[model samples]
Target chain A: MRAGERAYQALRADIVEWRLLPGQVLGEVELSERLGISRTPVREALSRLTADGLTEPHSGRGVVVATISAEDVRSLYEFRDSLDCRAAELAARRGDPEVFRALAGELLEALEGLTSDDDPDHASYYELVQRMDAAIDEAAANPFLRQAQTGVRLHLARVRKLSKSDPRRLASAAVEHQRIAQAIADGDPALAIATTRVHLSNALQHALNTKELAPVRPAAS
Target chain B: MRAGERAYQALRADIVEWRLLPGQVLGEVELSERLGISRTPVREALSRLTADGLTEPHSGRGVVVATISAEDVRSLYEFRDSLDCRAAELAARRGDPEVFRALAGELLEALEGLTSDDDPDHASYYELVQRMDAAIDEAAANPFLRQAQTGVRLHLARVRKLSKSDPRRLASAAVEHQRIAQAIADGDPALAIATTRVHLSNALQHALNTKELAPVRPAAS
Candidate 1:
C-alpha cells in the first residue's frame, strides 16, 4: 500500500480496536509524525474516520474520537438487534448450509483458541467476528445490509473493548453462535433471527454490567 | 444560522430533495459565489458534507457528490426491513396505544390536506413524513434503532426523491402509513412493523422502477 493508504488503514484499525479510545483528539501533525508521513495524508485519514463516525470535528476540541456512553451502548444494541437479526434471518432463507457449517467451524476454533490462559485474546476474537461477518455478508445478498452491518460492527467493537476479559460472555457467545449457525443451516430464519437477538441482548446486558477484563468463559463453563 | 451553516443546510436540502443530481461535481468557488459566501465557509461546508457521506474526495476528479445505485436502494430496503420490523416489534412490547392513536389521527389529517391537483406536493409530503417519523421514533424506544433509522433514512431520501412525483405511489404510501399507525395504535407491534416493512419495500421498488425524480421522503417519517 501507499504510505497514505497504509497510515489510513493503521489508524482505522486502532479506532476499530479501541486502542484509540473515545473522545481522544487526533492531531494531524502528531499523527503524521508518529506514522512518519505528511500532514496531508494524516488529514485525509482523519477525514475518512469522520465519515465512518469514529471521529467528529469539534470547533474547540479539534477532531476528537467519538465517545460511546452507556446510552450509546444501549442504542448500539437496539440497532444491532435489528441488523444482525435480519442478517441471520436472510442467511437462513437464502444462504447455503455449507457456508454456515464453515463459519461455525471457524467460530468454534477461534473460541477454543481464545480459551487459553496466557495472553489477551481481543484481537483474535475481533478477527473471528470478521470471519463470521464475512459469512453473514455473503449470505445477506444485500450491499446496503452489509454497510449497515459494518457500522454496527464498529460500535460492537467499542462495546467489546469496554467489556474485555469476560470469558463467560465469550463462552455464551460461542454457544449462541452455534445455535444461530445450526438454525441457519436448518433453514429456520425465524429461529436464527431470534437466537441472534438473544445473543445480542445478553451481550448488551453484559456490557452494561461489567468493565474490567474477565475470562472468555466462566468457572461453570 | 451563520452563512456557512446556512449554505450547508441549503445545499443539503437541495441534494436530499433531488434538485442536485448525483455524480454532480461541486466547485467550492462557484457555490460560495452562488450562496453569497466566501470560499472558506464553502470549503468548511463541503468538508461537513464529505463527513456526512454525501460527498467524496476524488484524487484527480476533485470532490464530487456521491451517487446512489439500484444496488444501493435494494440494500437500503433490506436494512430498513430489519430495522423497521424490529422497531415495530419493540413498539409492540413497549408502546402505549393511546400515544399512537393520537399520532394516527394527525397523520390522517395531514394526508387529507394534500390536494389532488397539486403536482408538486413533494415538499408538503416531506413535511408530513417528518411528523409521522416523530411518531415512529417515539414508538420505537431503542436509541440504537433510531440511529440506524437515521442512517437508512439518508439513503432513502435519495430513493424518495427519485419517486416522489408519483401521486399514486404517494397515495399508496398514505394508506400504508394509516395501516402502520393503526397497527401501532392497536398495540400490535408485529403488525405495525410488518406493515411498515411492506410500505418501505413497495416504495423502494417504485424508486427503482422510475427515473426522473428520486423521491426523497422526510428524514424521520
Candidate 2:
C-alpha cells in the first residue's frame, strides 16, 4: 500500500478508537518517524484527517485532534432526525418489501442471545443493522442524500465507539429495529418514518447516558 | 493563491457555468497548458473537482465533467426536500423571529418589478435568499447538517446556473419565498416545513421546465 494511504488508515482507526483522544496534538515529524514514514506522506494523512473533522489546526504548529462534546452529539441526533426519517420514508415508498421483511425476521431472531455478558452475538447484530442501512439507501435511490448521509455517519461512528451500551438498551433497540424494518416491509412510509423517529430518540438518550462510557455494543445495536 | 487552488477555482467555474460541457474530457496535460500551470497542479485540481462531484473519471484517461440530466435534477430536488424542510423547521423553532420577520418584509417589498426583462434586481434578490439560508443555518446550529447541505448545494448551484428562468415562474417564486419567510418569522415549525415543501415543489418544476435552458435567473429566483 502507498505510505499516505497506510498512514491515513492507521491514524483514522486510532482516532476513531479513542487511542488518540480529543485535543491531542499530532506533530507531522513525530508521526512520520513513529509510523516509519516520511514527512510528505504524513502531511497528506494530516490533511485528509483535517478534512474529515478528526483534527483541526493548532495555534503553534501541526494539528490537534478535534473534540466532539455531548452537545455535538445532541445536535447530531437532531440532524439525524431529519436525515434518517426521510431515508426511511423513501425506502418504504420505493424499496423491495421482501428485502426489509427478511431483515425484520432476522432482527427478531437476533434478539435471543443479545443479553449475554460475553456479547458473542453483538458483531453479527451490528452487521445486520448495517445491512438494513444499506438496503434503505439502495431503496431510497438518491445519490445526493447518500453522499450527505456518508458525512454524518462518519462522526456517528466516532460517537458510537465511545458509547457504552447496556444489554437493556440493546434489547430494546432490537425491537425498535424490528418495528422499523417491518414498517418498511409493509410499504408504509408514514409508519416507517414514525418508527425511525422512535429509534433515534431512544438511541440519543442511550448515547447521552454515558459519562465516559465503557465501550461495548455499537450504536443502535 | 497556489497554482493548484487557482486551477481548481477556474475549472469549477467553467464546469458550473457550462462552458466546460458534460462529457468533455479534462486531460491533465491539456488543462496544465491551458491554465499555464504544471502537471502536478493540474492533477491536484482535477482531484478536488472529482471530490466536489463536478467531474468524474473517464474510461480512457483523465476525467470528464459530470452530467446532470433532467432526471438528476429530479433526484436532487427529492433530496433537497428532505434537507431544506428540516432546516426551515429548525430555524422556526430556534431562530430569532426578528431576523426572519425582517427578511419576509424585504421579500414582499422585492415582489414589485420582479418581472422586468433586464433582471437588474436578481443579484440582490438572490443575495437576500442567501442571507435567509445563512440565518437558518445559524439558527439550526448543526455543523453536520451544514456540512451535508454544503455538498448538496454545490451540485444544485450547477443545476441552477444551467436552467433558464421565465418571468412568470420567477414572479410566482418570489411570492412563495415571501410565504416561506413569513412562516419562519412566525416561529411556527410545522408551517415553516409546509411552506418550504411547497416552494421546493414549484422550484423543481421551474428547474426542469427548460429542455435547452437559456440562463436567466438563479434556482430560487
Candidate 3:
C-alpha cells in the first residue's frame, strides 16, 4: 500500500476507536513524527479525514477531530436508516442466496455462543457484521451506493464506540442480523427492509439510552 | 478561494459539462498551463477529482477521466432513487413549508416559459432544479445525507451531459418537480417520496432513450 493510504487507514482506525478523541488537534508534524512517516503523508491523511467528516479545519488550530453531539447521533441514525434499509432491499433482490443462507446459519451459531454474558464475543460478532456488510455491498453491485454506505459507516463506527455494549443488545442484534440474512436469502426485499429498520431503531434506542447514562467527554487526558 | 479549490471547481465543471470528456488524459502540466496555475494546485485538484470518482489512475497511463457505460448510467439512476427519495421524504418532514410552496410557484412559472419548442429555457430550468436540490438538502438537515447526495450528484451531473435535452421531456420534468415541491410544501412525506420516484423513473427512461439515439464519445480532439 502507498504510504499515504497506510497513514489514512491507521489514523481512521484510531479516530473510530476513540484513541484519537474528539476535539483533538491533528498536527501534521506531530502525527508524522509519531507515526514514523513524513509530513506529506500525514497531511494527505488529514485531508482525506476532513473529507470523511472525521476531522475539520479549525480557525487558529489547523485540523481537529470532529465533535459529535446528541443531535448529531440522532441525525446519523436517520441517515443510516435511509442508506442501510435501501442496501438491504437491494441485497435481497440481487444477492447470492447461498451466501446469505450461510451467513444466517453462522449468525444463529453466534447467537447461541453469546449465552455466556461474561464473554461478550464482541470481536467475532463485529467481524460477522463486517462480512455481512461486505456481502451486501458486493451483491448490491452499485459503486455509487457502496461508496455512500462506506462514508456513512465511517461515522457510524465512531459513534458505535461512544456507547458501551450491552449483552442483551448484542444478543438481540445478532437475532436481527439473522432475520436480515434470512430475508435476503429468501429474496424478500420488503422483509429485508423491514428487518433492517427494526434493527436500526433498536440500535438507536440503545445508543441513546447509553449516552444518557454515560455522557461522552473530549478525552483531554 | 484557494488556488487548489479554484482549480478543482473549474476542472469539475469542465468534466461535468463534457468539455473534458471521458478517457481523456489529465496531465498535470497540461492542466496547470491551461488554467494558469502551478502544478501543485493541479495535483491537488486531480486528487480531489479521483476521490469524487471523476478520474481514475491507470497503470502506465497516469490519471484519466472515468468512462460511463450504459450499465453505469442505469446503476447511477438506481442509486439516485434510493438516496434522493429518502432525502425528499426527510425534506417534507422537516423542511420549511413556505420555501417549498414558493419553489412550487417558481416551477409552475418555469413550466409556462417552456411553451415554445424552440425556446427550451434549459439553462434557467437547470438552475431552478439546482435551487430545489439545495433547498431539499438544507431542509433535510442531515449532514451525512447531504454529503452522500453531493457525492452522488457529482457523478449524476457528468452522466446527465451524456444525453441531449428534449423540450417535451424538459416540460414534463418541470411538472414533476412541481409535484414534488407541492408535496413537500404540504408536508406529505409519503407523497414527496412517491413523486420523486415518478420523476426518477421518467428521467431514467429519457436518459436511456437519448443515450441509445446518440452515443457519447470521448472528446479526443
Worst-scoring 10-residue span by lDDT in model 3 chain A: A212-221
TM-score, prediction 1: 0.78
Question: To one decimal place, how large is model 2's interface RMSD in Å?
Answer: 1.7
Score chain B of each candidate by TM-score. Answer: 0.80, 0.90, 0.91
List interface RMSDs for the candidates, in order. Answer: 2.8, 1.7, 1.1
TM-score of each: 0.78, 0.90, 0.94
State the lDDT of candidate 2 residue by residue for A1-221, as single tens digits.
Answer: 87988998999989888788777889999999999989877877887787677888997588988788888888888888888999999999999999999999999888886865466549888999999999999999888878767767877888888767677888999999999999999999999999999999999988888645433322220
lDDT of 1 by residue, B76-118 (tens): 7777777777777777667778777776776676566554545
Better of 1 and 2 by lDDT: 2
- What DockQ does each prediction reach against the true complex? 0.56, 0.65, 0.79
TM-score for candidate 3: 0.94
Candidate order, TM-score descending:
3, 2, 1
> What residue pairs are clashing in model 2?
none
RMSD of each: 6.5, 5.0, 2.3
Please report, as a residue range, the 10-residue window in candidate 1 chain B with the lowest summed lDDT.
B212-221
Give candidate 2 misplaced runs (Cα > 4 Å): A39-41, A116-118, A213-221, B39-41, B116-118, B213-221
Q: Candidate 3: lDDT of B141?
A: 93
